[model samples]
Target: MPREVTSFSNALVKQARGLRDKKNRKREGLFLAEGLRILTEARETGVLPQTLFFSDASHRLLKELIDEVEAAGGEAIETSADILHKISGKDNPQTVLGMFPAFDTALDAIDRASAPLWIVAQSLRDPGNIGTILRTGDAVGAGGLILVDDSADPFSVEAVRASMGALFTQKIAQARWEDFVAWLRSGPGQLVGTSLKASADYQDARYEKPAFILVGNEQAGLPAAYEAECDLLVKMPMLGRADSLNAAVATAVMAYEVINQWRRR
Candidate 1:
């Protein structure tokens, strides 16, 4: 039988609410993933949460998820709507939210046989953009996401919500810029960077097998030093007055081109 938690003062409830902050989430090694899609993905992927919270109205709807949690040696709690809202950080939160363990894939986890494609975001700040990139990476069957330097939290609520469940399927890696560059140089892949200064159009660039497409921060773009490190630097044309594309859009454009190239071979 599942437990009932009515009070916001409950330790579990308080801990769930604390996940709203990045620091707390890091310290706790857990984060909140809300909505049915994300929970379903988590269950399917065997990334079961440590705890599951659902309101009375949601109990019937989430029975399968609740059962899976319990089967996986996790706990399920029936909580009040207020507590659900509190943990989700929304005025009217989803009836079901999960407290899942955070995950990070090592740089060496890539399987070479898969012809892996990795998306590298350097000093990215937009949670939504990161989420979209995760979704796009999953769509293209990319290897994983590499968040370099002070990139936005891929586990953030904004990013998770934007991902629409891709967050569960994708592998994420975080590293400092210098460390990541060293790993890249040592790794087996073509390091491609996107830049406005590059004379070559993106279409002209060859996205060979095992490619790592590096995208810059939204405002600053890729630094000159970093751009110079890439095996090749490509640029998307700007026929209109706009100087650049949205970070996510630019990544998606590059990702599909890479996928297309891989498919052709």
Candidate 2:
């Protein structure tokens, strides 16, 4: 039997809710993920949440998940919808909420040859963009997403929600620009950067396998220094008044190009 929690003030509930803030999440080393579909995806990926909270109305819907969590010695708490709302910080929150420990995002953990494509972002500030990039990475069969320098927190509630469960499917890493560059040079990989000022058309570039598609800040784009580090710099055509594509959109376009190139080989 799962424990019942009705009070919003409960210590566990409070701790889970605090994960909505980056500072709190970093302090606790846990992040909140809500919705049965996302939690189910996480479980399917062989990753179980440390703690789970679900409403009585959702007990039947989440029974399998609850059993699995309990089998793994994870905590399962049955709480009210109001309490669920409090934890998610949303009026109409998902019935199921999970607290998962943050993933190990060290650059050293990634294997360059594991996949034919990788997506890298620098100074990305939008959580939604981060989530969208993760979804794109999964879609394009990229190994993972490598966030470079001051990128938004991928574990935030908004980012987790935006990923639509790709958060679990995708491997995520964070590192500084210089460190990422150093690591890439030490491996058999091609660093391709997307930039507005590049003379080469993106479609014309011959993307090699294990390509690292790098995009920069949403507003400033890639720094001159960072752009200088890329082995190949390509520009997406902007037929409209807009000078550049959204960072995530640009990454997806580049990622597909890279995948298509590999497929052609």
Candidate 3:
């Protein structure tokens, strides 16, 4: 029995819960990953968790995962369900929560030569939307995903759930819009922002060079500042009356559209 943490007010529990805030996550440079699958994937990706809290009931279910983590020089802490909920953000708390190191996302890595296909969240606050977009970004093998200006924390349990563990695998570049834009200018790529109206349709846009696809919130599109920075604003052709799609869905359509074009050419 490696030190049981049953109390709700435990320091570690408080710390894990605090990860809900972006500031705390940034200060600690660590994020919470829930569920056995994410934990296993984190281990597979060479990102070992610092601490693992598992409900005793799920010990059997996650034993192999624990062994792998331990074999990889990681910690595995068996915990009670009571303590599990204290740290868990899930409605139906999963068996475990694992903490992993947060790496620095260098803006330099996002240069044109990197086949830069970027998904920028311009004030999109939904974790589900953010997570789905990240999954799409990883699926298309984009240069990176960027979360701008108080976007949802991808590490949140909801976001992680929404990503279906893609957060562990994706190269996410997060920063302010201004900083990201300045870095973008230095990189080799044409900036394309999503819009409801444009001179050219999404299928028609030329995705030449390091292409960045900017996506905005569901209710409102990209900010005026980003609009000024965008070289091209393109929209998906919709004959139906539905005004918009989910932020993530729109992002995927645009990102893969670029990929499709690149593959064809």
Top TM-score prediction, candidate number:
2
lDDT per residue for candidate 3 within 1-265, as digits (tens), equals 3456777777878888787777888899888888877777766666777777787534564776667667767777777776777677556778888877776665555555765576777777888887788778778987567777767777766787777778877777668877887877775778898776666788887887677788886678777777778899887987899978888888888888888888898
lDDT of 1 by residue, 116-158 (tens): 7889999899999999999999999986788888988988888
Estimate the Cα RMSD of every predicted model relative to the unseen true structure.
1.7, 1.2, 2.6
Which lDDT value does model 3 have at 110?
50
Per-residue accuracy of model 2 over 109-213 as CA lDDT, tens digit each: 898788888889999999999999998988999889999999899999989998988999888999988898899999788899987778999888988878899
Q: Rate the local accuracy (lDDT) of all candidates.
A: 0.85, 0.90, 0.76
Q: In candidate 1, where is summed lDDT lowest over 10 consecutive residues?
A: 106-115
Task: Give the winner by lDDT.
Answer: 2
Deviation in Å, model 3, residue 97 alpha carbon: 1.3
- For model 3, what is the alpha-carbon lDDT of residue 123? 77
Off by over 4 Å in 2: 57-61
Ordered from best to worst TM-score, the candidate numbers read 2, 1, 3
TM-score for candidate 2, please give it.
0.97
- Worst ten in a row by lDDT for model 2: 55-64
